[model samples]
Target chain A: MNDLVENVVKGDIRAVARLIRDIDDGIPGVREALKALYPHTGKAYVLGITGSPGVGKSTLVDQMVSHLRRKEKTVGVLAVDPTSPFSGGAILGDRVRMQRHSLDEGVFIRSMATRGHFGGLTQSTRSAIDVLDAMGKDYIIVETVGVGQDEVDVVKSAHTTVIVVIPGMGDDIQAIKAGILEVGDIFVINKADREGSDKTLSDLRLMIDMDQKKYEDGGWKPPIVKAQAVFDKGVEEVLEEVEKHRAYLLETQGEIDFRRSPKRVREELMDLVKNRVIEEVLGKLTETGDFDAAVEAIARGEKDPYSACDELVLPRLEIH
Target chain B: MTGKRRIRIMVAKPGLDGHDRGARIIARAYRDAGYEVVYTGLHQTPEEIVEAAIQEDVDMIGLSSLAGAHNYLFPRTVELLKEKGADDIVVCGGGIIPDEDIPTLKAAGIREIFTPGTPLDVIVKWVADNVEPRGEY
Candidate 1:
């Protein structure tokens, strides 16, 4: 175990990849590996890229990775794709876009499957980010499974989230007006060479202007860049905007702790605790057949659900 | 892990192979078989395929070549995996290959070869029966 941790910390690509796989598979005892890796994290700048499918999130990420690599930064990429609910399988084809960096020792790209998890990312994605961070990646780019409205979980993990959209999304632009639009630190209008780009750009500008009061109050105003990722146009400007956002965060916060604010840390801790407690309690109930009996009793109308809940949980809880 | 561990496979079209219909079909088959398959797209080099397979921590690499470059591409991929000390990742090949070349390819550490018209289930089952997740947790 120590050797595995040591190898990962040493930035051994094989060790890092294996640890991430184990984490994703929910292998027992991998938590010890994560515990060891945690101290080594908080070094990599995490960037989240998300948008609707076919909007060129992967192409944009591929371009950004090339730019970052040219600046001599080591990068780790976790590109996620959705799993098949029916077969519990997935075709992780995002690596197809970023294959140019496959042989580069400085870049490690891992494609992840959502594995039945909602919100555009798998449960293990957070830990996988930590694994790459621990492996000494200068930047870790997490591209979410081409997201729609409400798949905004990437914002929780990224220091700066880049939301990519193409021209002519039509009603899709209105659909994103709710959840995903609010979380972007940077917005990209990729495939800007296509028709209807101006309308999309203007629509986004109008939306940003509508929130002008928030920026007037000295909050960071998200910058939108028009890009043709396939043609490699506007990529540098997008990267520049990302750098500007990072600088703003650093200037405001004094020190950027790899994008995790105190609030995010608190939320992460609470989530972990909640998950652990649920797993333990549910495991115990199912093991003792209490859960099944409660369900059967409820179905038979022998007890109301509220009292049944108290009957099952109230005893388990020690009251003051 | 308490539950069944998911197998990951890289279905790569190495060496300028524009014919990827077979590759895509096999990738879909692998996915349907409950394996997380990374399809690296067309025109990948042997080095790229091996590096991707390792970085993904995949259990196997299903090398698909139809451009008559399998003799070099398949063996090169296998050799690169060995060179990178990732030889534990099982390697297999499919696509246009002569019967005479199969023994040499197998000798070069290609695990199994499936010719054209082989059933998809057969390949999936071969993978399920032969490949376990590589390395200890």
Candidate 2:
């Protein structure tokens, strides 16, 4: 186990892959592995790609990875796919699109299933990113299984977020704007060879313009790039904009970090603390018989949930 | 003891076998049994299967080959995995295999062969009873 963590930190692909599986499986001692890995993380720049299915997001990732690799950058990709609610199976076909890079040693790609995990990325995903980051990957790309406003939690895991959309999807524009507009660091009009590609680009530009507060806030303006990812066209341009976004973040590190990182850290800390506290409280409550009695009382309509929550939580609250 | 580790299995169809009814069924069975299943859609090569197994760090490689290339592709996959230092990944196969060919395949490191009519539960139980993730469990 110690050797596994050591090899993972040394960027051993096999060991890195094994640790990710261990973390995914919730195997014992993986927490220690991640703990050992934690100090070596935060070195890789996390890039998130999100778009509705059929927008060619996977192909875009493939092309972007190639472009990054050409610059001698080592990349790690996490392709998120939805787990079957009934069977827990996932096709994980993202690798099919990116098979051209399968033989490349510098690229490490893993497919993840959402598996009903709430929030942006699954808990496994965060740990997987840590593994990749600790492996010293220069760039980590997370391609969301499905992109929408609801999937904005992905932004929590990414330093720069790329929102992809294709031509001829007029009806999806409004909903996309509402859900992901604020999160996009770069907007890509993939399938630029299509008929409505120009119109789609203009529509995104118009939306960005309309949101003046996003500009007044003085953050970097998101750039819209045209791409035909299948042909590998315009991928480099999109990546250039991504690099610019990264440079902008570094140039204005304090402001961007203050605006984004602290809230993200707080949310992550709260998620951890909340789960641990709930587990402790629930175990104690179950042991003390109050949980079952409360359940029975609630079922019998004798006690309201508001009062019950107080009865359960008041004594546990610590005044700091 | 297995503990509560969720076993991950990759069900792959290699060498142009488009008939995926059996592969999909087994993938679903593993999923329903609470194991994480990574299904490589049809027409994968031996190299692709080995690469997927290594990258995914799967506990087992469930190759479903109906194109009669299992005699060649299945062992080649195991060999490639061994060459890549991932020989510990358990390799199993299911498809149109004649009774006479099973011994040679097993000797070549194909761990188990599930011919037609092999019950899904049987395969699931076999995997549960046989496979564990590499390293100290």
User: What are the Cα lDDT values of the candidates?
Assistant: 0.86, 0.82
Candidate 1 at residue B53, lDDT? 87
Q: What docking class should model 2 receive?
A: acceptable
Question: Candidate 2 on A1-320: residue-level lDDT in tens?
Answer: 78988888888878988887777665678778888888888888889899889999999999899989999999999998877777655666687787667678899989877766334244668789889988989999999887654468666778899999999998877777777877888999988889999889889999888877867888678899998999989999998898899888888774443225777788667766764566466657777998789889989999999999899878876654
Flag regions of model 2 displaced more than 4 Å.
A87-89, A117-122, A148-150, A254-264, A282-320, B1-3, B16-22, B117-122
Runs of candidate 1 exceeding 4 Å displacement: A117-123, A148-150, A258-260, A285-320, B1-4
Cα deviation of A15 in candidate 1 (Å)?
A: 0.6
| Candidate 2's TM-score on the B chain | 0.94
Best by TM-score: 1
> What DockQ does each candidate score versus the true complex, computed on alpha carbons?
0.68, 0.47
Per-model TM-score versus the true fold: 0.93, 0.87
lDDT of 1: 0.86
